[model samples]
Target: KEILLLLVADMKAEYIPPREDVIMQNESPDELYIIVSGEVEMLESEMENEQTVWTFKSGDMIGEVGAFCCRPQSYTYRTKTLSQLLKIRTSNLIEAMKTRQEDNIIMIKNFLQHHKKLKGLRLGDLLHGVGGDYGDPNMYVNLLTVASTGNAT
Candidate 1:
């Protein structure tokens, strides 16, 4: 919370009503949002189907990956309820990180730890994201098998 406060102290805050899109799929947003209140749902739209990939609430950082990697948002985020958010442009976020190297590393470590603990799976499941993003379920399963047993070919 302190870290987020520091990051957002100089940024503008926005209020979004329920069901409004925060991050649109296929549109690259150069900013990351720190949710101050309310819920946001992350959705992935493929063809005519839109799937709920995740839901984030107060204190959660949305669009971190895009902000960190400078890539287009792969999912769309919409408010599930009335929301209050602090927006930090990617350039500013990067600059802040650069100025606070130790804190930034800790933040990155926390994110990695969160990913490791995600969905209650072991190390094997970590690689599932790689395949899932590429639309290859078989590859995920295969990679899980390999990762779990420490087998390589």
Candidate 2:
């Protein structure tokens, strides 16, 4: 909670209307948005004949991958309703996580917690997000297989 408190202290709370784009595909992702209330969608362009799209609600954080890694955004995020989003720049979040270390260490758990149970919008209605966003069931199954069996098939 220390990390979240620190981040929220520096984060900006905004009321976003429907159809507003928070992050665009292929853009340099500098900030991460946390859905405070309402819904957002993560959409990716077609890749290997499969496109991934996910509907995320409150408590979901989007764009952390690109924000933290400084990679091109793999997906675009758009608000679906009058959503309340907590926006924080990557630098600020990093700063929050980098508090004085000698006394205590910080752990930001579930910072990227995606509600896999929340319905998926693509890949034959399969829950395909936050599993590397590959949009392939076989890929996810293989990962699970390797994870459980300790060997790749």
Candidate 3:
């Protein structure tokens, strides 16, 4: 279905200078980014401290989970060197996906798999309590309420 062409139709290329922060921890993802060049560092932030937990290079993608699931990303990403990135706004991608049901389903599956890999990365103790569960502690309650109330609520 040429998902790349569908996504690229409304894509924006970003040129980020060294040390620029591209994504921040706990912020809801609005866009998905594919690294085109240079380097990006993913940082784990807690309290007032932040540390680099991973480094992303050309061809790596970020914000897939947040863009697909409308959740917050657990790590913050910043450019470590001059970087070129291809960005796709969530709204645009969703709009295109709606036109092709099969492709949309496959894309969502891929995003979920990508999220799983992020969690499985070997970090051990540093990852004891890190990752996607950073959503609202009350979100589950709201979801249950919606389920009981009705999907139209």
Best by lDDT: 3
Poorest 10 consecutive residues of model 3 by lDDT?
122-131
Off by over 4 Å in 3: 112-153
Return whichever of 1 and 2 wins on lDDT. Answer: 1
Model 1, 72-130: lDDT tens per residue? 67678999999999888878777776676567766666655655554653323322233
Scored against the true structure, residue 114 in model 3 reaches a CA lDDT of 52
Residue-wise C-alpha lDDT for candidate 2, range 1-153, written one tens digit per residue:
666678778889999999898987777768888889999887765654424377778887887756544456767788888899988998887687677442122222232123233443332223223345444545543443344344565
lDDT for predicted candidate 1 compared with the true structure: 0.69
lDDT of 3 by residue, 1-153 (tens): 566687878899999999998988777779989999999998888889988877888988877656654666767889999999999998888888888766766665554455447654632221233334554434533443343344545
Ranked by TM-score from best down, the candidates are: 3, 1, 2
- List TM-score per model, in order: 0.70, 0.64, 0.71
Instruction: Report lDDT (Cα) of residue 83, candidate 1.
Output: 99
Clashing pairs in 1: none
Residue 38 displacement in candidate 2 (angstroms) = 1.2
Worst 10 residues of 1 by lDDT: 121-130
